[model samples]
Target: MTGGRSPRRAVAAADRTRQPTEVRRRLIVEAAVPLIAERGSSSVGVRDVAGAAGVSVGTVTYHFGSVQEILSEAMVLQIERYYAALSETADRATSAAGALRLLVDALFTEDTDRHWRMWFEYWNAGEHHLDPAFAGGQDRRYESWHRQIRALAERGVADGEFTCADLDGFTTRFAALADGLALQRLRQAPPLTTQDARRHLHRFIETELGPGPHGVGLGPAE
Candidate 1:
């Protein structure tokens, strides 16, 4: 045999050389996301993420600084993706009432179940742990969600599709109701189905905003 490195060793070296810094960072973060969702942010370790990402622990630390940083970034990434989807849904609505209905549908669907689970995991982590990054990210998520819902409420009022004397109060109440219903659907035995949650939320919206133009109501028909 010639004086050359083995094939496997050469391939490994090439792989390492070909991987870009940003690619490596994203791999680690993406790997961490599912782990955090499955096991909660507080439960995952740096080595676990590195192993899952097929990188060394040093590589994870190099990119994210710490497990907490990786967890925080993963949470932020999920929320950003979710907001993008919500914005897309909002863009397709024919009216503000339709927008609100579509938003509720988007939130409680099977596609969002993992996201809701991860969210509650983060909420639990926030209660027991004291990481400022995680806490700050959670707060920003709450504020962003509230801001979007409030904007939708304002639009409905402006279009005279809804009648609310206190927009902010209505937004807060609506958001709280959504959160509570989602939690119940996630945590309860004989869990609340998406249809059940939608019906409850639509009833609440009707109570808060009244019927839309020509008694069309604020949500889709059952």
Candidate 2:
């Protein structure tokens, strides 16, 4: 099954509707992410996802083989949406920093915010052993975020709008801050929105990379 066409490539909404295997497969996993998010992955089963997705238990087992398969698929399901949003926003971006801003905002959108919730749930549940899927997803996600931030810092330096003594160090610093901020917002719905996160980020960059290697002079500071 792993060697066969990946669900991602096979993911065709209209086409999925046309294929029973694809349709059941998609439903089973899509239903599983939230299940695992709300209930620990170990507690979630193929039957659970099938019931939630309104499909037969047999159908879920047929597509996923076991609870492990279902949970692993859920991991993929959670991150795929976030990456898709990032890619789409990046495509429309004119600047690297703008792309980074869009990436955070997209993840925090009211309807899409559950992925963040799901992430915390996964970690809290110690799900890696159960799912064994998307093993490097967190590292990959951080790398992508850091790459964008570094590019933005470089661009600011080039445009004389920002400065940074060490691009790599600053990127890591901000990525850590972004995560802490995301977690805070998730647990407590801070006064800060994703917009606030980006605004603070922009201000931080201005300080690190702006005039005299600091300060955006962005006028009446927030």
The models' CA-based lDDT, in order, is 0.77, 0.62
Model 1: lowest-lDDT 10 consecutive positions:
1-10
Clashes of each: 0, 4
TM-score to native of every candidate shown: 0.84, 0.70
Q: What is the lDDT of candidate 2?
A: 0.62
lDDT of 2 by residue, 1-222 (tens): 112221222244464456677767776678777666665676675556756676666666677667776776676678667666677787697754455556556655566557766666555544445433345665575577677668766765666554567989888887777667668766666566766765666555545554534435232233
- Model 2: per-residue Cα lDDT at residue 173: 81
Worst 10 residues of 2 by lDDT: 1-10
Q: Write the per-residue lDDT of candidate 1 for residues 1-222, one digit (tens) a residue.
A: 112221121124347667899877877788778877766776688777766677777877788766877776777788688888998999799888888888888888877777887777767767765777667878888988888988987888777786778889988998899989988988876579988888888888878886555444474444
For candidate 2, give the lDDT of residue 160.
Answer: 58
